[model samples]
Target: MLFLVAALLLLGVAMGSVAHAPLPVSLVAAAVIGVWLVVFTVRERHSRRHSS
Candidate 1:
């Protein structure tokens, strides 16, 4: 799906940026990515449940 692709692209960009960033910056970016993934998962599950 488009949303999934967009999420993956964003994740890739974040990871790439993190690779060149300082340790503290990398950590914060990692945390934000983690939270984004969690939110995406929850939304996907909720949408599926309701659609079914």
Candidate 2:
């Protein structure tokens, strides 16, 4: 999870620098991170419920 966030952030920065389009790259990265976080949280909750 942390790795994914870091990778996306780095990719965003690299893209922004190369493309000179920080807004789009940053928005994409933010959306990806948000989706990832939501999925992770949901999966964690499901696993905990099943385990218990």
- Alpha-carbon RMSD, each predicted model: 4.9, 5.9
Error of 1 at 25 (Å): 0.1
Each model's TM-score, in the order given? 0.64, 0.60
The sequence of per-residue lDDT tens digits that candidate 1 reaches over residues 1-52 is 9999999999899778878899998888779989999999999999999999
Judge candidate 2 at residue 42 and give its lDDT: 100
On lDDT, the candidate that comes out on top is 1
TM-score of 2: 0.60
Instruction: Report lDDT (Cα) of residue 3, candidate 2.
Output: 100
- lDDT tens digits, residues 1-52, model 2? 9999999999898866757656787788779989999999999999999999
The residue pairs in collision within model 2 are none
TM-score of 1: 0.64
Clashes (N, CA, C under 3 Å) per candidate? 0, 0
Query: Residue 49, candidate 2: how far off, in angstroms?
Result: 0.4
